[model samples]
Target: MSILSGILITLIFLGIFISPIIGIIAGPKIQWNNQMKDSCEYFDTRISMGTHFPESQYNIRSLDQSVHDQTFFLAPVFAPQADITAKYQYYHRFSGNTANTAHLAIDVDLENAIWRMMELDGPDERTKWAAVGRKRDNAALPAFENVNQTVIYNGTIEQLGPHLWIPDFMMLIQGIDDARQHCEIEPFIRVFDVQGAPIEYYESLIQPKWNWSPEWDEYLMMRTASFGLGRQRLDMCVRENNFRTFEFEEDKYKGVSDISFVPLAIIASYRMRFSEIGRLDCSKDIMDKARDMI
Candidate 1:
């Protein structure tokens, strides 16, 4: 063949081989870049930090006095309501003479995590895992529709266990909803020093890491059966990974406690609308329990 003919043949082969590979890689890269841009805009504009953090936001003296005063001072008491769902309607109807102590029940929903393990696409800076897919993404993130309220907790982090560091000091939180019978609650922590500078921020949507016991599943099944809901339908809702129960280990961080005032922020779906539904008086018994929990 002539030199031109040979060169033309080589070019044709390269196009056939390289074009497909380029198309395959480029398609996802372009799509992911667009998705990331959408995600960033969504988070920045829609999500609220809940509390206004001023320049002296971290300063102890300069902190919001109202928030500081309420922290660890008042117990979150769910007010009486007759309009609630049938599941918890009994709790209100039967409590004529009983102390409103049932309000102290802490049903924290930690399974609905707002952040996820993100694998970024190199060159494109797009996420390898799309947050769109419910199962395929493998990581869950908070979205505008999913989040309703924003709460901030100011407190100090103390060593709970060898590897567990939890906020153990004065805690301030806002936008807590007692109305919802079932909702996701996410808590964010902002630790500040005496100098009014932030130390660290921790936020997570927690799911129960432990496997559900057969006994637990059985109990749930029995409860749903009473409601006339089919067992199969309830089974679909009761995913083992969806729920977790949390309780503070009083024995763990008992004393020699280093107190630091930090802020805990949360965005939840329920609103603490107690205007119409009067708040229960913070009785000595209730206040004592609330203090102990903190």
Candidate 2:
């Protein structure tokens, strides 16, 4: 090849390599930020969809229909967003046959389950579990779409029978007590766009009928971390006779919740501000016009 032709090719290759650097230098002067429309407008569009919101009459049912030994409920305090919903389930001892004492546990969606699975299994060991699922149906679980009328969170809580009592606090369960006694659980309600990005986040506090166990503190913390909640070990903690164990591992308590139902008070408290999580149109472009000194 001629020297000039070879030199031209070399310069072309060099320019390609340096173009990214040049763009980086020039990027600061160019405003690439896309402008989005008002978030409230998006919420307004979603509200126009006309879906049923949470009402005072919360529904509680059994995750396990066969036995129905234990009952659970994920009663929404207010109207949730179309995409995002807040669910709360606890163990109910007043349901079915206690002869077998079988606990029915609910599971989170596959995606969240995989995350917890990875957390428990070290990074190195996760690959094996991922490969374990062979069937297509058992493969990657589908993302939660428009679950119009289904409760998502499925953790259980057990009310300590009026037997055990500690002077320091309203001690119902031994070996597993936390400061959550009579604590107001204010769950942050987040609404996500079609792209799975959260567009709006608000708070709604559920008034506790009874003090929750310390075991649930972590569960509550994790549930509040996302607009979409997941399932955990929905077990029960009961006050057997005069003594109470940290947590009851019996099968009957699985998916069992024991939160008391107070219709009027719960409805009143929830109506304070967030009565309904309005929907929004995430299609518009909004921009931040702030000047950064840096």
Candidate 3:
């Protein structure tokens, strides 16, 4: 072939051979770039933070004092109706008191305060693993084996029915009280997040279901809180680079002797009321009301 003809033919062949490869290679890169850009924009337009808890030393005494004062006034708010027979009967089953039933009005102000601190610290920076530490020898059955084989086997089978009868009830009551108190204090936390645009919201995806009695109820309540807070914090981390991801550390709170002050995880999912680009205004009324309630 003539020089020009050969050159033209070669150019044509090169274009045909290389074009598909170029397209294949560039396709994923282009898509990835677009996704990265979109993600960056999504996070940039919204405020988010990693999981974190307040680093300040938590004062249990102060929290207790606050609870004492608040409960003193609020106790009357939940005052038993003139006829508390029904209420008494309901709790009597749990409390095991037929006469002069014990009234349990759990105060959750401490829980709220702890949660607020957690929110302020953000989820990204907080530790994930809860250190349960060493619990008292509270196990009902001593770690002893019966000499009689039949009796040992029967005892094992019988004990399988329910493990947490009383503790579960206590935890359920505590969780309910905690949730109510959290609702009361939510407004304050909103103010704390005012500077940043609201983080991208996600509906709570985790739910607790109860199949057993007290244990089921207690587990559901605790799981609800943990999953709810975890979802919220995860979304925040995804939306805004401010919050840290959760990393569970084993046995960190293991030595803690105070059962009441044991560390607990919080999880919740929320949706942004407005688009990321939308304007946000803090509500003074809400803030004021929350402060007053506190």
Candidate 4:
């Protein structure tokens, strides 16, 4: 090769080798002041399409009937541009179960599951869960969408229970509890029939959830984390019962949750800890599920 060509090739190789070294030595990242989004929350553990968003799989929007359980879905972040009808349909707990223990004990009564919600100038002053003094008992602000809803069937007692937008914020959970309990630790709600009314007590309120999608299975919000945080454990501290022990991969970080459910109050006062986890199976994705069900 000519001397000029040789020099060019040698310089190219050196540039590749030296760039990384310079980056590490000169502080790779710029440190900036922390800013918090008071409006929205970022969840550490993502929901697995496998996790029951809606209480019954039959309600999930699926083209195929037999494979409803295999449908891959997660609660979509409320994007103004996205179609609300389709996107937000993924995360909910609606049950048609007529059994006495409805919605897996996550819900006992539909209307009163959550006592109140934190929203600015929410419509429906009749809203049961509005925070009274934050915005106002009278100030009129634009209505913000909350993913929580309870549907009572038209002509039947069997109705779908409500599972609100369960934001994965344990600290927020504590704040909510403090508002109600006022520094007093109370026992979880022990559901029992009140005056012949059957009440269901759930052992757990939340559990770790995850999602995975292969490169070939290109779909919205299904792609694995763009940054490729592979094979992470969805660490969480959710309400659970004394009988069950939540175990993770290889028995690592075993038994980190014991929070029991508080009926009629979605954000109750007993949850404290970040010990439970649902691990991600990075080896396969939606393609694997589709093929297996087919």
Question: By how many angstroms RMSD does model 3 differ from the true structure?
Answer: 23.4
Q: lDDT per residue, candidate 3, 151-178, as tens digits?
A: 1000000011211111211222122222
lDDT per residue as tens, model 4, 115-158: 22111222222221222222456666645564333432111011
Once superposed on the true structure, which residue ranges of model 4 sit more than 4 Å away at CA? 22-294
lDDT of 2 by residue, 55-77 (tens): 22222233345423322222222
Model 3 segments beyond 4 Å from truth? 1-9, 23-30, 42-294
RMSD of each predicted structure: 24.4, 21.1, 23.4, 20.5
Question: What does candidate 2 score on TM?
Answer: 0.19
> In model 2, what is the error at residue 78, expressed in angstroms?
20
User: By summed lDDT, which 10 consecutive residues of candidate 2 come out lowest?
Assistant: 113-122
TM-score of each: 0.16, 0.19, 0.17, 0.19
The lDDT for every candidate, in the order shown, is 0.22, 0.23, 0.21, 0.23
lDDT of 4 at 213: 16
Candidate achieving higher lDDT, 1 or 2: 2
Output the lDDT of residue 286, model 4.
Answer: 35
TM-score of candidate 4 relative to the true fold: 0.19
Clashing pairs in 4: 53-92, 54-92, 55-94, 116-129, 117-129, 239-259, 240-259
